[model samples]
Target: MEDINLDDAIKLIKDDMHSYELLHDKFLSYINRDPDLKNLVHSYKSRFKDLDHLKSKIERKNHEDSMLPEDEQKGPITQDNIQERITDICGIRILHLYIGQFEAIHKALMKYVNSNELALFEPPKAYTWDPEYSKTFEALGVSPKLKESFYTSVHYVFKPRADSNITCEVQVRTLFEEVWGEIDHTFNYPEPSKSKVIQEQLKVLARVVGAGTRLSDSIFELNSLQDAE
Candidate 1:
Protein backbone atom coordinates (compact mmCIF):
# COMPACT_ATOMS: atom_id res chain seq x y z
CA MET A 1 0.00 0.00 0.00
CA GLU A 2 1.32 3.46 -0.90
CA ASP A 3 1.97 5.97 1.86
CA ILE A 4 -0.88 8.43 2.37
CA ASN A 5 -0.24 11.74 4.17
CA LEU A 6 -1.54 12.46 7.69
CA ASP A 7 -4.40 14.67 6.39
CA ASP A 8 -5.62 11.87 4.10
CA ALA A 9 -5.37 9.33 6.94
CA ILE A 10 -7.32 11.52 9.37
CA LYS A 11 -9.91 12.15 6.69
CA LEU A 12 -10.28 8.44 6.09
CA ILE A 13 -10.80 7.88 9.85
CA LYS A 14 -13.35 10.72 10.05
CA ASP A 15 -15.21 9.43 7.03
CA ASP A 16 -15.63 6.07 8.71
CA MET A 17 -16.14 7.48 12.21
CA HIS A 18 -19.90 6.92 12.17
CA SER A 19 -19.41 3.20 11.53
CA TYR A 20 -17.15 2.96 14.55
CA GLU A 21 -19.78 4.72 16.66
CA LEU A 22 -22.30 2.15 15.52
CA LEU A 23 -19.90 -0.67 16.41
CA HIS A 24 -19.50 0.76 19.91
CA ASP A 25 -23.28 0.83 20.34
CA LYS A 26 -23.57 -2.72 19.07
CA PHE A 27 -20.96 -3.85 21.60
CA LEU A 28 -22.81 -2.13 24.42
CA SER A 29 -26.06 -3.83 23.39
CA TYR A 30 -24.37 -7.22 23.19
CA ILE A 31 -22.85 -6.94 26.65
CA ASN A 32 -26.10 -5.70 28.15
CA ARG A 33 -27.97 -8.68 26.70
CA ASP A 34 -25.49 -11.29 27.94
CA PRO A 35 -26.58 -12.22 31.45
CA ASP A 36 -23.30 -13.82 32.41
CA LEU A 37 -21.26 -10.90 31.14
CA LYS A 38 -23.59 -8.33 32.65
CA ASN A 39 -23.40 -10.09 36.03
CA LEU A 40 -19.60 -10.13 35.94
CA VAL A 41 -19.23 -6.45 35.18
CA HIS A 42 -19.79 -3.74 37.78
CA SER A 43 -19.81 -1.05 35.08
CA TYR A 44 -19.27 -0.57 31.37
CA LYS A 45 -17.84 2.46 29.57
CA SER A 46 -16.80 3.15 25.98
CA ARG A 47 -15.44 5.85 23.65
CA PHE A 48 -14.28 6.42 20.15
CA LYS A 49 -10.78 7.90 19.86
CA ASP A 50 -11.10 11.66 19.46
CA LEU A 51 -9.88 12.95 16.09
CA ASP A 52 -7.08 15.03 17.57
CA HIS A 53 -6.10 12.17 19.88
CA LEU A 54 -6.03 9.81 16.95
CA LYS A 55 -3.84 12.19 14.97
CA SER A 56 -1.44 12.52 17.89
CA LYS A 57 -1.26 8.75 18.23
CA ILE A 58 -0.42 8.23 14.57
CA GLU A 59 2.30 10.87 14.78
CA ARG A 60 3.66 9.29 17.98
CA LYS A 61 3.78 5.84 16.41
CA ASN A 62 5.42 7.20 13.30
CA HIS A 63 8.09 8.90 15.38
CA GLU A 64 8.59 5.81 17.53
CA ASP A 65 8.98 3.60 14.50
CA SER A 66 11.22 6.14 12.71
CA MET A 67 9.04 5.56 9.66
CA LEU A 68 9.18 9.11 8.28
CA PRO A 69 12.24 10.62 6.66
CA GLU A 70 14.29 12.86 8.96
CA ASP A 71 13.61 16.01 6.91
CA GLU A 72 9.93 15.03 6.48
CA GLN A 73 9.46 14.14 10.13
CA LYS A 74 7.57 17.36 10.91
CA GLY A 75 6.00 17.55 7.46
CA PRO A 76 2.76 16.04 6.25
CA ILE A 77 3.15 12.39 7.34
CA THR A 78 2.17 9.82 4.75
CA GLN A 79 1.23 6.26 5.52
CA ASP A 80 -1.30 3.62 4.58
CA ASN A 81 -0.76 2.08 8.02
CA ILE A 82 -3.46 3.89 10.00
CA GLN A 83 -6.48 1.64 9.38
CA GLU A 84 -5.21 -1.80 10.37
CA ARG A 85 -2.43 -0.39 12.54
CA ILE A 86 -4.70 1.38 15.01
CA THR A 87 -6.62 -1.17 17.09
CA ASP A 88 -8.46 0.86 19.71
CA ILE A 89 -10.29 3.34 17.47
CA CYS A 90 -13.45 2.09 19.17
CA GLY A 91 -12.97 0.93 22.76
CA ILE A 92 -14.94 -0.39 25.73
CA ARG A 93 -13.98 -0.88 29.33
CA ILE A 94 -15.54 -3.51 31.62
CA LEU A 95 -15.03 -2.96 35.32
CA HIS A 96 -15.65 -5.90 37.65
CA LEU A 97 -16.04 -5.81 41.42
CA TYR A 98 -13.31 -8.39 42.02
CA ILE A 99 -10.18 -9.74 40.38
CA GLY A 100 -11.51 -13.30 40.39
CA GLN A 101 -14.30 -12.36 38.00
CA PHE A 102 -11.84 -11.66 35.16
CA GLU A 103 -11.25 -15.28 34.23
CA ALA A 104 -14.91 -16.20 33.95
CA ILE A 105 -15.71 -13.16 31.82
CA HIS A 106 -12.71 -13.80 29.63
CA LYS A 107 -13.79 -17.40 29.12
CA ALA A 108 -17.31 -16.36 28.25
CA LEU A 109 -15.95 -13.86 25.70
CA MET A 110 -13.87 -16.60 24.12
CA LYS A 111 -16.89 -18.82 23.93
CA TYR A 112 -18.80 -16.03 22.23
CA VAL A 113 -15.97 -15.57 19.76
CA ASN A 114 -15.75 -19.30 19.08
CA SER A 115 -19.48 -19.67 18.63
CA ASN A 116 -19.55 -16.63 16.33
CA GLU A 117 -22.04 -15.00 18.67
CA LEU A 118 -20.87 -11.46 17.83
CA ALA A 119 -20.46 -11.99 14.11
CA LEU A 120 -16.70 -11.86 14.35
CA PHE A 121 -15.00 -10.23 11.37
CA GLU A 122 -11.99 -12.42 11.84
CA PRO A 123 -11.21 -15.86 13.22
CA PRO A 124 -11.15 -16.49 16.99
CA LYS A 125 -7.37 -16.84 16.90
CA ALA A 126 -6.96 -13.20 15.92
CA TYR A 127 -7.86 -11.94 19.39
CA THR A 128 -4.96 -10.68 21.54
CA TRP A 129 -4.82 -11.35 25.33
CA ASP A 130 -1.14 -11.41 26.34
CA PRO A 131 -0.63 -8.38 28.56
CA GLU A 132 2.43 -8.85 30.80
CA TYR A 133 0.93 -7.27 33.92
CA SER A 134 -2.20 -9.45 33.83
CA LYS A 135 -0.05 -12.57 33.41
CA THR A 136 2.01 -11.50 36.45
CA PHE A 137 -1.10 -10.79 38.50
CA GLU A 138 -2.55 -14.24 37.77
CA ALA A 139 0.79 -15.94 38.36
CA LEU A 140 1.44 -14.19 41.69
CA GLY A 141 -2.09 -14.84 42.97
CA VAL A 142 -2.89 -11.39 44.43
CA SER A 143 -0.07 -11.15 46.94
CA PRO A 144 0.59 -7.70 48.40
CA LYS A 145 4.35 -8.08 48.17
CA LEU A 146 4.15 -8.79 44.48
CA LYS A 147 5.75 -6.00 42.47
CA GLU A 148 5.03 -5.68 38.80
CA SER A 149 3.65 -2.96 36.62
CA PHE A 150 0.41 -1.95 38.38
CA TYR A 151 -1.28 -1.99 35.00
CA THR A 152 -3.83 -4.78 35.20
CA SER A 153 -6.25 -5.15 32.35
CA VAL A 154 -7.01 -7.96 29.91
CA HIS A 155 -7.60 -6.59 26.39
CA TYR A 156 -9.36 -8.14 23.44
CA VAL A 157 -9.77 -6.87 19.86
CA PHE A 158 -12.94 -7.48 17.90
CA LYS A 159 -15.09 -6.24 15.04
CA PRO A 160 -18.82 -5.58 15.36
CA ARG A 161 -19.59 -7.99 12.54
CA ALA A 162 -17.96 -10.24 9.98
CA ASP A 163 -18.20 -7.72 7.17
CA SER A 164 -16.64 -4.70 8.89
CA ASN A 165 -12.97 -3.88 9.34
CA ILE A 166 -13.36 -1.46 12.25
CA THR A 167 -11.75 -2.83 15.45
CA CYS A 168 -12.84 -2.33 19.03
CA GLU A 169 -10.76 -2.94 22.13
CA VAL A 170 -12.31 -4.39 25.31
CA GLN A 171 -10.45 -3.78 28.55
CA VAL A 172 -11.39 -5.76 31.68
CA ARG A 173 -10.29 -4.56 35.09
CA THR A 174 -11.23 -5.02 38.76
CA LEU A 175 -12.70 -2.14 40.74
CA PHE A 176 -9.51 -1.52 42.69
CA GLU A 177 -7.43 -1.62 39.58
CA GLU A 178 -9.87 0.71 37.89
CA VAL A 179 -9.42 3.23 40.68
CA TRP A 180 -5.66 3.21 40.26
CA GLY A 181 -6.03 3.40 36.48
CA GLU A 182 -8.20 6.51 36.65
CA ILE A 183 -5.76 8.39 38.88
CA ASP A 184 -2.82 7.25 36.85
CA HIS A 185 -4.47 8.13 33.57
CA THR A 186 -5.28 11.60 34.80
CA PHE A 187 -1.70 12.46 35.67
CA ASN A 188 0.38 9.97 33.73
CA TYR A 189 -1.34 9.04 30.50
CA PRO A 190 0.12 9.47 26.97
CA GLU A 191 3.24 10.21 28.96
CA PRO A 192 4.36 9.67 32.54
CA SER A 193 4.72 12.57 34.95
CA LYS A 194 8.26 13.86 35.35
CA SER A 195 7.82 14.30 39.11
CA LYS A 196 9.81 11.64 40.93
CA VAL A 197 7.65 12.05 44.00
CA ILE A 198 4.42 11.51 42.07
CA GLN A 199 5.83 8.44 40.34
CA GLU A 200 6.87 6.87 43.67
CA GLN A 201 3.54 7.79 45.23
CA LEU A 202 1.66 6.15 42.40
CA LYS A 203 3.67 2.96 42.87
CA VAL A 204 2.86 2.95 46.59
CA LEU A 205 -0.81 3.56 45.77
CA ALA A 206 -0.74 0.64 43.37
CA ARG A 207 0.42 -1.65 46.17
CA VAL A 208 -2.38 -0.38 48.37
CA VAL A 209 -4.89 -1.01 45.60
CA GLY A 210 -3.50 -4.50 45.14
CA ALA A 211 -3.83 -5.23 48.85
CA GLY A 212 -7.36 -3.86 48.90
CA THR A 213 -8.40 -6.12 46.05
CA ARG A 214 -6.96 -9.11 47.89
CA LEU A 215 -8.89 -8.21 51.03
CA SER A 216 -12.08 -7.87 49.02
CA ASP A 217 -11.50 -11.30 47.51
CA SER A 218 -10.90 -12.81 50.96
CA ILE A 219 -14.07 -11.26 52.34
CA PHE A 220 -16.09 -12.72 49.49
CA GLU A 221 -14.55 -16.12 50.06
CA LEU A 222 -15.34 -15.97 53.77
CA ASN A 223 -18.93 -14.98 53.08
CA SER A 224 -19.28 -17.85 50.64
CA LEU A 225 -17.91 -20.25 53.20
CA GLN A 226 -20.29 -18.97 55.87
CA ASP A 227 -23.24 -19.39 53.53
CA ALA A 228 -22.17 -22.99 52.80
CA GLU A 229 -22.72 -23.79 56.47
Candidate 2:
Protein backbone atom coordinates (compact mmCIF):
# COMPACT_ATOMS: atom_id res chain seq x y z
CA MET A 1 0.00 0.00 0.00
CA GLU A 2 1.14 3.53 -0.73
CA ASP A 3 1.95 6.01 2.04
CA ILE A 4 -0.22 9.04 2.81
CA ASN A 5 1.48 12.41 2.61
CA LEU A 6 1.48 13.68 6.22
CA ASP A 7 0.61 17.24 5.24
CA ASP A 8 -2.27 16.23 3.00
CA ALA A 9 -3.78 13.84 5.55
CA ILE A 10 -3.52 16.34 8.40
CA LYS A 11 -5.12 19.07 6.29
CA LEU A 12 -7.98 16.77 5.34
CA ILE A 13 -8.60 15.83 9.00
CA LYS A 14 -8.39 19.45 10.16
CA ASP A 15 -11.06 20.36 7.62
CA ASP A 16 -13.45 17.72 8.98
CA MET A 17 -12.81 18.20 12.70
CA HIS A 18 -15.85 20.45 13.16
CA SER A 19 -18.23 17.83 11.82
CA TYR A 20 -16.75 15.30 14.23
CA GLU A 21 -17.40 17.65 17.14
CA LEU A 22 -21.02 18.03 16.05
CA LEU A 23 -21.36 14.25 15.92
CA HIS A 24 -19.86 13.96 19.39
CA ASP A 25 -22.42 16.37 20.82
CA LYS A 26 -25.26 14.55 19.06
CA PHE A 27 -24.27 11.15 20.55
CA LEU A 28 -23.74 12.64 23.97
CA SER A 29 -27.26 14.07 23.93
CA TYR A 30 -28.75 10.71 22.99
CA ILE A 31 -27.26 9.01 26.01
CA ASN A 32 -28.44 11.75 28.33
CA ARG A 33 -32.03 11.38 27.11
CA ASP A 34 -32.35 7.62 26.95
CA PRO A 35 -34.07 6.70 30.23
CA ASP A 36 -32.53 3.26 30.60
CA LEU A 37 -29.08 4.51 29.74
CA LYS A 38 -29.35 7.51 32.07
CA ASN A 39 -30.11 5.26 35.03
CA LEU A 40 -27.57 2.60 34.12
CA VAL A 41 -24.60 4.90 33.71
CA HIS A 42 -23.10 6.42 36.82
CA SER A 43 -21.57 9.09 34.59
CA TYR A 44 -20.36 9.63 31.02
CA LYS A 45 -17.63 11.54 29.21
CA SER A 46 -17.12 12.39 25.53
CA ARG A 47 -14.54 13.96 23.21
CA PHE A 48 -13.66 14.13 19.56
CA LYS A 49 -10.09 13.15 18.77
CA ASP A 50 -7.63 16.03 19.01
CA LEU A 51 -6.01 17.05 15.73
CA ASP A 52 -2.44 16.61 17.03
CA HIS A 53 -3.26 13.20 18.55
CA LEU A 54 -4.71 12.10 15.22
CA LYS A 55 -1.55 13.21 13.44
CA SER A 56 0.59 11.35 15.98
CA LYS A 57 -1.58 8.23 15.66
CA ILE A 58 -1.27 8.21 11.90
CA GLU A 59 2.52 8.54 12.11
CA ARG A 60 2.69 5.81 14.76
CA LYS A 61 0.52 3.35 12.80
CA ASN A 62 2.48 3.88 9.60
CA HIS A 63 5.76 3.49 11.45
CA GLU A 64 4.62 0.28 13.16
CA ASP A 65 3.43 -1.11 9.82
CA SER A 66 6.83 -0.38 8.28
CA MET A 67 8.54 -2.53 10.92
CA LEU A 68 6.52 -5.61 9.99
CA PRO A 69 7.29 -7.82 6.96
CA GLU A 70 5.48 -6.89 3.72
CA ASP A 71 2.85 -9.64 3.84
CA GLU A 72 2.18 -9.27 7.53
CA GLN A 73 1.87 -5.50 7.65
CA LYS A 74 -1.51 -3.81 7.58
CA GLY A 75 -1.89 -1.21 4.84
CA PRO A 76 -0.84 2.35 5.64
CA ILE A 77 -3.48 4.94 6.56
CA THR A 78 -4.39 7.09 3.56
CA GLN A 79 -6.27 10.37 3.18
CA ASP A 80 -8.84 8.51 1.09
CA ASN A 81 -9.80 6.34 4.06
CA ILE A 82 -8.38 7.99 7.16
CA GLN A 83 -11.75 8.90 8.64
CA GLU A 84 -13.16 5.47 7.86
CA ARG A 85 -10.09 3.66 9.16
CA ILE A 86 -9.99 5.58 12.43
CA THR A 87 -13.41 4.74 13.80
CA ASP A 88 -13.09 6.49 17.15
CA ILE A 89 -12.82 10.08 15.99
CA CYS A 90 -15.62 10.91 18.44
CA GLY A 91 -15.74 8.83 21.61
CA ILE A 92 -18.17 8.46 24.54
CA ARG A 93 -17.30 6.61 27.70
CA ILE A 94 -20.06 5.19 29.93
CA LEU A 95 -18.99 4.45 33.49
CA HIS A 96 -21.00 2.56 36.08
CA LEU A 97 -20.20 1.28 39.57
CA TYR A 98 -20.88 -2.45 39.43
CA ILE A 99 -20.06 -5.29 37.04
CA GLY A 100 -23.59 -6.67 37.35
CA GLN A 101 -24.85 -3.45 35.80
CA PHE A 102 -22.95 -3.78 32.51
CA GLU A 103 -25.39 -6.25 30.98
CA ALA A 104 -28.25 -3.77 31.35
CA ILE A 105 -26.14 -0.87 30.14
CA HIS A 106 -24.98 -2.88 27.11
CA LYS A 107 -28.53 -3.96 26.30
CA ALA A 108 -29.72 -0.35 26.47
CA LEU A 109 -27.01 0.79 24.08
CA MET A 110 -27.72 -2.06 21.68
CA LYS A 111 -31.22 -0.71 21.21
CA TYR A 112 -29.79 2.08 19.10
CA VAL A 113 -27.73 -0.45 17.18
CA ASN A 114 -30.70 -2.76 16.68
CA SER A 115 -32.91 0.09 15.52
CA ASN A 116 -30.23 1.39 13.17
CA GLU A 117 -30.23 4.76 14.86
CA LEU A 118 -26.54 4.06 14.99
CA ALA A 119 -25.05 1.59 12.57
CA LEU A 120 -22.70 -0.94 14.07
CA PHE A 121 -19.28 -0.10 12.65
CA GLU A 122 -17.58 -3.00 14.40
CA PRO A 123 -18.57 -5.90 16.58
CA PRO A 124 -18.45 -5.11 20.30
CA LYS A 125 -15.24 -5.99 22.11
CA ALA A 126 -14.88 -6.92 25.79
CA TYR A 127 -11.36 -6.30 27.08
CA THR A 128 -9.82 -7.95 30.13
CA TRP A 129 -7.43 -10.74 31.13
CA ASP A 130 -9.09 -12.16 34.24
CA PRO A 131 -10.67 -15.60 33.64
CA GLU A 132 -13.62 -14.89 35.97
CA TYR A 133 -14.23 -11.47 34.46
CA SER A 134 -14.00 -13.02 30.99
CA LYS A 135 -16.87 -15.32 31.89
CA THR A 136 -18.91 -12.35 33.12
CA PHE A 137 -18.71 -10.82 29.66
CA GLU A 138 -19.25 -14.13 27.85
CA ALA A 139 -22.35 -14.95 29.86
CA LEU A 140 -23.88 -11.76 28.50
CA GLY A 141 -22.90 -12.84 24.93
CA VAL A 142 -19.83 -10.63 24.44
CA SER A 143 -16.64 -12.51 23.66
CA PRO A 144 -13.60 -11.52 25.68
CA LYS A 145 -10.32 -10.55 24.04
CA LEU A 146 -7.23 -10.69 26.21
CA LYS A 147 -5.63 -7.28 26.61
CA GLU A 148 -1.93 -7.92 27.24
CA SER A 149 -1.66 -4.73 29.24
CA PHE A 150 -4.67 -5.94 31.24
CA TYR A 151 -6.55 -2.75 30.46
CA THR A 152 -10.19 -3.60 30.88
CA SER A 153 -13.24 -2.10 29.12
CA VAL A 154 -15.99 -2.90 26.61
CA HIS A 155 -16.01 -0.96 23.34
CA TYR A 156 -18.62 -0.43 20.63
CA VAL A 157 -18.26 1.48 17.36
CA PHE A 158 -21.22 3.25 15.76
CA LYS A 159 -21.76 5.42 12.74
CA PRO A 160 -24.74 7.47 11.57
CA ARG A 161 -25.45 5.09 8.74
CA ALA A 162 -24.04 1.90 7.26
CA ASP A 163 -21.57 3.85 5.10
CA SER A 164 -21.21 7.15 7.00
CA ASN A 165 -17.75 8.58 7.52
CA ILE A 166 -18.68 10.13 10.88
CA THR A 167 -18.40 7.64 13.73
CA CYS A 168 -18.31 7.41 17.52
CA GLU A 169 -16.92 4.75 19.85
CA VAL A 170 -18.61 4.06 23.20
CA GLN A 171 -16.60 2.51 26.01
CA VAL A 172 -18.32 0.89 28.99
CA ARG A 173 -16.42 0.17 32.16
CA THR A 174 -16.83 0.24 35.92
CA LEU A 175 -15.44 3.16 37.97
CA PHE A 176 -12.75 0.82 39.26
CA GLU A 177 -11.55 -0.08 35.76
CA GLU A 178 -11.55 3.59 34.83
CA VAL A 179 -8.96 4.31 37.51
CA TRP A 180 -6.76 1.44 36.31
CA GLY A 181 -7.05 2.56 32.67
CA GLU A 182 -5.96 6.14 33.45
CA ILE A 183 -2.81 4.82 35.14
CA ASP A 184 -2.08 2.48 32.22
CA HIS A 185 -2.64 5.35 29.76
CA THR A 186 -0.10 7.52 31.54
CA PHE A 187 2.61 4.86 31.21
CA ASN A 188 1.85 3.56 27.71
CA TYR A 189 0.72 6.46 25.60
CA PRO A 190 3.00 7.94 22.81
CA GLU A 191 5.41 5.16 23.77
CA PRO A 192 5.23 1.81 25.48
CA SER A 193 6.64 1.62 28.99
CA LYS A 194 10.08 0.02 29.27
CA SER A 195 9.70 -0.33 33.03
CA LYS A 196 8.84 -3.96 33.77
CA VAL A 197 8.25 -3.13 37.44
CA ILE A 198 5.54 -0.62 36.56
CA GLN A 199 3.89 -3.10 34.16
CA GLU A 200 3.75 -5.79 36.89
CA GLN A 201 2.17 -3.38 39.35
CA LEU A 202 -0.45 -2.36 36.77
CA LYS A 203 -1.33 -6.04 36.26
CA VAL A 204 -1.79 -6.47 39.99
CA LEU A 205 -3.95 -3.33 40.09
CA ALA A 206 -6.15 -4.78 37.34
CA ARG A 207 -7.08 -7.72 39.60
CA VAL A 208 -7.90 -5.37 42.42
CA VAL A 209 -10.11 -3.38 40.07
CA GLY A 210 -11.97 -6.54 39.08
CA ALA A 211 -12.45 -7.52 42.69
CA GLY A 212 -13.80 -4.07 43.51
CA THR A 213 -16.41 -4.41 40.80
CA ARG A 214 -17.45 -7.86 42.03
CA LEU A 215 -17.66 -6.73 45.62
CA SER A 216 -19.81 -3.78 44.65
CA ASP A 217 -22.13 -6.09 42.71
CA SER A 218 -22.44 -8.43 45.65
CA ILE A 219 -23.39 -5.64 48.05
CA PHE A 220 -26.10 -4.36 45.73
CA GLU A 221 -27.52 -7.82 45.13
CA LEU A 222 -27.72 -8.74 48.81
CA ASN A 223 -29.28 -5.44 49.75
CA SER A 224 -31.90 -5.80 47.04
CA LEU A 225 -32.76 -9.35 48.15
CA GLN A 226 -33.17 -8.20 51.75
CA ASP A 227 -35.43 -5.30 50.78
CA ALA A 228 -37.63 -7.66 48.72
CA GLU A 229 -38.18 -10.07 51.66
Output the number of the TM-score-best candidate: 2
Candidate 1 residue spans exceeding 4 A from truth: 1-4, 67-79, 119-149, 161-164
Worst 10 residues of 1 by lDDT: 121-130
Which tens-of-lDDT digit does each residue in 85-144 have in candidate 1? Answer: 776888899888876676677676766666765554333221112243445445533222
Poorly placed runs, candidate 2 (over 4 Å): 1-3
lDDT (tens digit, per residue) of candidate 2 on 1-229: 3556777877877887777777677778777898887888899888777877778788789888888999997778888878778888788898998888888888887777789877777788899887887887888778899978988999988887787787788899989999999899999987879999999999999989888888898999999999999
lDDT (0 to 1) per candidate: 0.70, 0.84
Alpha-carbon deviation at 229 in model 2, angstroms: 1.3
Instruction: Please report the TM-score between candidate 2 and the true structure.
Output: 0.93
lDDT of 1: 0.70
Shift of residue 144 alpha carbon in model 2, Å: 1.1
Per-residue lDDT, model 2, residue 201, is 93
